[model samples]
Target: MSTTSTEPARRAGWRTETFARLDERLDRVLGATAKEFEKLRVRTVGDLMLHVPRRYFSGTELSDLSQLRVGEEVAVLARVLRTDVHQGHGGRSARGGMNSRLTSVISDDHGRLELTFFGKPQVMDYWRRQLTPGARGIFAGKVGEFRGTRQLTHPDFVILGDHGEIVGGAKRNAVLAEVTRQPLIGLYPATAKLRTWTIAQSVGLALDQLAGLPDPLPAAVRRQARVIGLEQAYRAVHQPQSKDEIDGGRERLRFDEAFALQLTMARRRADAKAHGAIPRVRRDGGLLAAFDARLPFTLTAGQVEVSEQLMSELARPQPMQRLLQGEVGSGKTIVALRAMLAVVDAGGQAALLAPTEVLATQHYQTVLKLLGDLAGGGLLAGAGPSTDVVLLTGSMPVAQKRAVKLKAAAGEAGIVIGTHALLGEGVQFADLGLVVVDEQHRFGVEQRAALSAKAAAQPHVLVMTATPIPRSVAMTVFGDLEVSTLKEVPAGRADVGTVVVDAKNHPGWVERAWQRVIEEVGAGRQAYVVCARISSQPKRKSTDAYAEDLDTDPGGEDIEPAAAAVDVYAELSGGPLKDLRVDLLHGQLSSEEKDAAMSRFASGETDVLVATTVVEVGVDVPNASMMVILDADRFGISQLHQLRGRIGRGGHPGVCLLLTKTAAGTTARDRLDAVASTRDGFVLADVDLEQRREGDVLGASQSGGRSSLRLLRVLDDADLIAEAREIAEACVAADPELIDPGLSDIVTHVERQAAGDWLERT
Candidate 1:
């Protein structure tokens, strides 16, 4: 992998052959151990390489006591001149808490340091007994100020029988310098077995075997990109002597991954459309004509622009893969309906898929109102039920769903709207030509594929998102597919006045919220009260994260769960707004129940709806002009922007109140200030990316454990990511299927990642 330092030259020790044989035996033993290695399915050497380091321990060498700072990592060669051990256990806590303390003391030539261990006295005794007083050993630990004196605690210990144990016949003090001169060190992530006198350095040894692997790319491309092969990259990453080389190596690898991704997309697009061509859909100007005549107002420039883009794409014989990105209330559905009408006019059915039942019903109603007479007593005009625009959610009776499906199949309906129920057994598309997915981010790349697969020919797909992102990021991230941005709200849409209020004044703000909702309800309008958390904790990532997932308590009442969604709804329902209709909806509601409730809200049967962000994007109720978020400081910049997009869709004036507690940190406060300052989703998305990451938006849908990219922290990795994406593309363009022996290691690593079989060899 690297030509820097190949091996340790023999100095004066056991013959190299003997040591080599011992090393080989150990490797064989680890490999044959069968520690559920089968379950982990480490079936090949390649899988072993992808088992990346969670964090490396660099194992710092710090002998100069003055360089010993508290909370810093350091390594030292110390012998146990004297030793002491202590044991303790939990006596009794106020109510609930464990009790135990295990500690020890060991000294070297220069000084002595305490070793504290928690929860296990038995284990401490075994370790202390092994390193009896006067026994020499190496120690490693985090140095800290204790009683105004420098100290090392709970460090790794190595029992050295003689000076030879130091690796180069060095004393305790000389060992620091010895390690400092070397550029490589095994950095193991913090583990539970720190009491061990020695560890196998399992990952490092495994990685070494995986390094300096064969290349996998084509020679011509490799020469053009001027980049090192894969194994070299990994070595540079873990063993770089300087930051520049490390960055360069990581960039090459990141670029390679992105390039592979781009190639995959390109190949998929080509394969999907290579089949017999589908006919282009064009509106006879009949259904579209009728709908336009019934519209109450003109579309905004942003809406018009996206509508035209969809129209142009749909007009093509090749299936369109365009995405419609519109901020909340930016009129995305309107454009969808226009495109659907065109497809129906061209004798094809249209379908819109939503992530949830409530959203499906909401889209159904909006389309019903927007396309009033067209769906009501329309001359079927040869369009099917899918084009006629019916709802197909799980909440509906089986008979009703089947009837809807039958109508859609029999060409009774021209357009269909539903959740995944549309994908159920026996469901069929008549002449489905266009498919629209609301909140496209809620689904994955595969699910998106499944949605389009249901059509006869791969239908033209239009994915819509209310979460706006900066054009640059959208272009880079969505560059593979066509992206159309809806950046303007249609005329007559009123601006929702926004306000920021602290929770120290929460009661007052709550009272004011009550007054406003009551006043709005007096004129017959609904209100939404959103909350961040049910409770507060010191260790949570952030308060905004709390809002996304508010736990509910069925047994606890009175004040309700710490998350305000339920309680606030209860309070408002029974408070001054008692005369007005009010309701609650969140994840807790069953599909059918949520559907029925949200339907009522959409039809104006219910005046107010108090809920979490569940209704943030997909549900569009034109009359909902008031939104109140409790613990607003707990939300990220992007979320607040989306929440604000919910209101101000109608001609009437609306308002948004961001209520939070005074305890919010500067970051939270500053985020809120940004929210109070603007309503641009794209600008906010950039700010949000700076504040959060794609992870923030996709947190709930993660398939594996939390993401791990050493070079990519949302706050700092933008540049690295950009560079990596570029390089990955360049390198992959050189070699599509990595076959260069020198770079085979990279392909091996990625293959294992794709197979989901990443693990360590030793």
Candidate 2:
């Protein structure tokens, strides 16, 4: 047999070993080690194959010695400049010398590194010969520093020939083709329990056993895209022979991810079109027109354009699946209200779902204020030919809740605004033609599906978010829906300025933040004091999505918790703002207490509202001219922007102070600085995506220890995504049901990896 065939036969024992079954359960193949793989969610051989390396470290990609950090495990491929064997110190060594160390100086074009070895004369001589001047090899070791110089001690290494083969270690001519593979180290996303090398070994074993895998991409499509076949892609990614192979492998995998996702979206669009929706067309001089005519200010051009688009979609027979992404304080609520009024005009009820009770109440009051007597349909004298707007919430008195439910059931309530309570049983809409979800990310897909299920037919869905989504994200995250952006900040909005206060470098700035709040309150305006937590306790409720705001690490060393709402409220009430009215609000508070606190603040009875991120959205107090966010580094870019949005309303120039103890050069501090630098939500969204992984942006779990994207970079691969989208649409057009089982399987796998809300089932 040829040396290449014999090497695998001898090392793998493939002569007796059966071919690895791709469909085999991991537990069967991995034995006890299967438990470790389970942590990474690799349950089958196929899953293991798909767990491609996150990155490869090759000679060209290795960092120079100057870039090495102390106590870091690293791999370096460099030319050996010189070698010296010496004995050091007075202490007796195993060979009767003071721990003799061999130092070899190695260099790349950029810098040099020291490789130290400690051994007897024979071993030292061997190393000396192997690491002579001008010799090139791969050195793997943990970096250390002695006398301020970086060094690697007794590193694991392989001396390589000019052609990249292990010198004198194996036969040259017969296995030259196989052994000349580039010296590249594939780094898997590893965990403490399973190291990267272990995973690589397992992958190597699987590759050796498996062969001739079916290609999911059609032959013609593969040729058109110029991507490698599935089997070749897997082999290249897992054990690439060259950098070109790695690139080819990653391109195919990226295309696969994008194609599968786009196909799912295309199918969803087709299904939405197929499912009939009653056209809730507008009526002239109806509630929408009446509401629009009485507007205190002219609608911005962006709002008018989006509103027109929404109305036209609502007039269609197909259900409208549209996403309205707007900047903070861009008057999105007004645009949504107009659409709701249009639905009411068509004799159908519109249900608006808010993520929080506070937001629901805010919307309820806003609608009532905007409608004035027009909201009192059939219930009051001198009322217009309008419709009733009702607020439904979990904390409402049982009798009041029952009455509201009956009105909704009897078609008397034309507009229903509520939290998740609207999705509960017995809350019926007589003719639910529209469903509007505010802060769409706050709820899951099941919640949205539940609300839509209430309508007799598929309800025209309009989901809105004040946190502007980048166009790429909108295409990937909300691919199933049509996207509309409202960037025009209405005229007369008070210009808001943001400043980052470095509490660590300048502790006085924190005190100044509190004083600023006092100053705003003294000027007859309100202010908000926001914190990252409700308490200093280390505990966090899993149900609270914002629990990440707490700076405490659950698994690492105990830390001094970030500022808490309750603690800040107490301190301010007694110290800085003793003369002013102050109240506290957080998710832990009872619903009544939260409402009362918000009400007090809204009515100017409370000069300062100390709260957690509960005030991040929809609690509008236009008179609130200042915001002091403590431990602001804990909040995200989008969240900081949203909290800042609460201010600068009602033509009161706003000031936002971001207080953070994070050091100036840290990533956390950089995030805070970015937020302070721009008020544009879209710019911040891009910054946020740049800082976070694609999996985080999509809200998917890192199943294989890396992003669900694996190899696809959402921001950098926009052209690839667009091409995949085009190809996907064409594929769906030709085979609407995805008759090819392989293509169907790919789509199903993609759906499993995504957030469940990305797809909606009829």
Q: Evaluated with TM-score, which candidate comes out highest? A: 2
**Global lDDT scores for all candidate models:** 0.59, 0.76
Q: Which segments of candidate 1 are over 4 A away from where they belong?
A: 1-200, 241-244, 377-387, 471-479, 504-507, 519-525, 532-561, 575-580, 590-592, 599-607, 633-635, 698-762
Candidate 1 lDDT over 560-647, as tens digits, reads 2235666767777887678788888875688777877788887898878878777766667778888888767656676688777777
lDDT of model number 2: 0.76
Candidate 2 stretches greater than 4 Å from native: 1-25, 38-47, 57-61, 64-183, 208-210, 377-384, 394-401, 444-446, 538-559, 700-707, 755-762
What is the per-residue lDDT of model 2 for residues 1-762, given as tens digits with 9 covering 90 to 100?
011111122223221111135557777766777788886768778778778765675544444666655555666667888999886532466657555567899988788889988766666777788888987766766677789878887776666666556673112233222323536667565544575556777776667656766676788778877799877988888888778998998889888878877887786677677778999898887788788888888999999999999999999988999999899988899989999989988878899999888889889988999998779865211136688899999888999999999989988888999998998898988889899999986654456667888888888999998877777767776787899999989998898899998888898877777788878888899999999888877644332222222323312333567788888888889998998898999988777888889989989899989999898888888899999998887777788889999998988899999988777765567788888888888888888778764644664211111245656778888888888888888888888766765666665555444433333211
What CA root-mean-square deviation does each model show from the true structure?
Answer: 10.5, 8.7
**Predicted model with the maximum lDDT:** 2
* TM-score of each prediction: 0.72, 0.82
Worst 10 residues of 2 by lDDT: 1-10
Displacement of the residue 572 alpha carbon in candidate 1, Å? 3.9
What clash pairs does model 2 have? none
